[model samples]
Target: MLPSLLLLFLSIPLTTVTAASAAPRCTTSTPIKTYQKCMNLPTQGASLAWTYHPHNATLDLAFSGTFISPSGWVAWGLNPDSPAMTGTRALVAFSDPSSGGLLLLPFILDPGVKLQRSPLVSRPLDLPLLSSSAMLRSDSSVRDGAGLHIFATLRLSPNRTRINHVWNHGLYVQGYSPTIHPTSPSDLASRATIDVLSKATEMGPAVPSWFRTAHGVLNAASWGFLLPVGVTVARYLRQCTSVRPTWFYGHAAVQIVGFLLGTVGFSMGIIMGRASPGVTYTLHRGLGVAAFVTGGLQAAALLFRPKTTNRYRKYWKSYHHFVGYGCVVLGVVNVFQGFEVMGLGGSYWKLGYCLALSTLIGVCVALEANAWVVFCRRAEEEKVRREGRVEEHQVVKASIGI
Candidate 1:
């Protein structure tokens, strides 16, 4: 019995050794998060996988993706708090446009990700880069035709396992071209993001779907669709002499209603900004305010409208026309800016808007040409009548011999 017990004890340690040796060193199959988009992003797909080893206080992270660009820049980053790119620690890799060789560096995404300025490559939060612990491998061969496949490993801050960690990761890429310099900010914006949660399907507080839907519908309808419609009515419909008061009333009614709707949409945008703590669309917000103020001035002008016979009427007409057109231009521009802010840039929303505006412009061009033709005919007829009257008066004077 004692010999059998000794044999069992010896076999246990041997079995443990074999199991440890066979354990997979890299975490690949089970990723904590994934982001996939059918859109033609440079990094077509990305994933995050991690394993924590308590013995050495090491956190192994695998940030891997497929880069379609043969050159330019590709990056993945972790944001400790919010998903905004400003506060992130990123690992960037690219084929140096100047050298034609791969270059990898760590960058801190601060002061926002911009396309005009260069990125600052350094450790964020003073985290040390464990150069010895890092490994970057890529498949750049034509036989692999799947494009550039990059797999990178990074060491996190020491004792990261003990701290409760909440993370979100983002992927960004810019394609290489002759005009695009490596040091220059990318002309093309390509990016995606996903939350890394400890528990699957768990997420932070999100803005309600209904609120977002209302905001989009209201703004698109008011600023993009209705404001242009109002402008068209004022410019073209009012030209019909038969309509007279009808055209004026229609113009006023449509302008008033559109302005009111736009005001509501603008208010909702303000509320949304407040709800979102760290997000701000400065250009969109500024343009929206300008549109609203111009629109309001137009509305007030109606209240103080002067009679046509009044001398100041000419001045009012000039002011009203200027402000009205200005409002329309500003409103349309801000709507496009809003699309980009919401990540709907280059989307079908923008395409639909362009199509609608183009149609309106075509109609205006046809109507304007017809108006000029009518005015020229009327002026020529009046000139002929005046000449005939002058000839008749001369004939009568000569016949009377006086």
Candidate 2:
């Protein structure tokens, strides 16, 4: 298993993209679409779109409009069903007349989550997701900071970005302008769209594109590293031994590492989605969360089991059996889904997992058959002993009566 993990690291090729130029004055992120394609010409709904290059191409952004305010703009995007839009300078709505569709402005929202914190743990962000680039909420707005610089904290949506560990090295594009626009409502003057893509240009070798690729590599590596083979090893141990100690330790360790990588990787997925909202990315986020939640349940069960109690001590077999099986099933299913999302739909990874599981199943069946044979032989021997004892007792009772 350790060898397989080590090989996994060496296997996935790493790719990075650095910026080629400097941040131009009044620049927006490239492949900047007009309001037309953002609407999806014919059957237009909420749009979410993006591209996944192998860390070679320049950063792609859709919304290109720049605000000219003296103070920095406080930009935020939320579902109206969430925080309803008010007329405050901190909030603005961009509603298109033709579509009657409202979207938030700018490139800020991340995937894997959306704007809500109710008891309902998860909900589809419902934005139209597309590959390459996506449209923003047409009804959203940005309020100027004293009408000069734009600054705001974007509450992340798991569906928007892969809420990965990339936060430590976040790619933010902050712009400070000289004048404030009189036409704007806030205290400041001029406005501009500071795309993170341009920030990549300014960084020389330190580009935002590299972060994007890093996010993908982590996602692939996490999903690939375990879950498939680990699940098989853990479950196979169950049919062989009632204690399932090997199964327990193996499953726990794999899950711990798998989830850590997944958490960081999933965060990147969310970031990708937020950078570009689309169905493929959103589905990826949803599955990632599902895996995380199930893993948590499995971990919690292991934690709460009363290993010290008398009954538990005796029934450790039962606890181990159930938990082991559950982990195997969930882990296997999630691994399959992860591979599909990671663009390895028909790749060697799929073949390897298939053969490994099939082989494990065969081994488990053989072991179970052997156990049953042993059980049957023991039952027959016990029956003979009981019959002989009954005859002896009958003879002794007759002698006593006489």
Candidate 3:
């Protein structure tokens, strides 16, 4: 099991690298028109293609994104000051309310949008946006039947090389107003810096990739694997006469290590939540909190454990067992939730976790069956010994009476 876990951990970096390398590159071969340079955006499986004319200081660009729903909206824009949603001159595309046809309109995202003070109504941009158009075309590459493309021409200030770009998608619009998008980590971190002259691009500020990976690994190992293993050890090992008090020590040590690791992972999670202010995983967070609290209580119970001769010892034992098992269940469930939160629901990381957990369960089942067999055999032997003693007593009594 340890070797399997190590292999899984080592493969994490490789998987991340492979996924990044596999991102589709942008190309100047759109069905509408051709472009000079192109690059893939960092999030949302989106891409940008553009032709920059330095002499005229004009840019012709196409932004492509998969539609999340039939009534959803897609947007791409330039943030003149910073790579953030606020203060962006954006082009939003959605189905027109009047004709049910594709509509592309410009809107300036100010601080009000962030505050959600009112609905997002389209208005003229303050920048020199020459012309804008949009189209919905059938795309086999996308999960949805169609893809959204926004084409536009803009005149930029002379000598301007780099620009901050922000893009996002939403699931609904109300009476010609595009509603706020989902507050997922991907949605919140959907901005980048692009250089038109050099055709260079860089992802905007977000949580460090390494930190997220470390958080997942630590939690999965501690709450997901080690805690359950410790429970199994305590359940079966203590039954053997040879391992008696040694089993208790081993169980305590394993649980302590697991709890300590889980606490660190939980702390990392809290830090991440604070870092990404708007994003929330309510269920996952709740589960983690519950598991951590239960584990902590279990640890504390050890200090106040009642002696075997005390009348309340049975109650303490019951409490310890109940809390310990509850913690294990919560931890395993939250581990799966963690995978989904990290967007690894269908990845090999999840598969590896499942395999490890399944192996542990199988081991427990085998041990339980063997224990039952051993218990029944011992009962049968004790019964036979009692019957033999009774027969010998009867024989001695008959001889004395004769």
Identify the leading candidate in terms of lDDT. Answer: 3
Task: Please write out the lDDT profile of model 2 over residues 1-402, one tens digit for every residue.
Answer: 989976754544333211122222232222343211111100001111223222443222232233333222223233322211221122222332345343233332223112322211212333332222123323133222111111122333323332111000011112321111122111110111122322211111222444444665564445544654455566456555666677768766876777677678667666654443212334545656765665566566666677565576657657656654554454456567656555556878678767766776787688668768877988999999999999999999999994
Worst 10 residues of 2 by lDDT: 163-172
Error of 1 at 104 (Å): 14
The number of clashing residue pairs in each candidate reads: 0, 84, 0
So what's the TM-score on candidate 2?
0.42
Q: Poorest 10 consecutive residues of model 1 by lDDT?
A: 178-187
TM-score of every model versus the real structure: 0.56, 0.42, 0.56
User: Candidate 1, after superposition: displacement of residue 238 in Å?
Assistant: 2.5
Q: Each candidate's root-mean-square deviation in Å?
A: 17.1, 16.7, 11.6
CA shift of 370, model 2, Å: 2.4
Predict model 1's lDDT versus the native.
Answer: 0.58
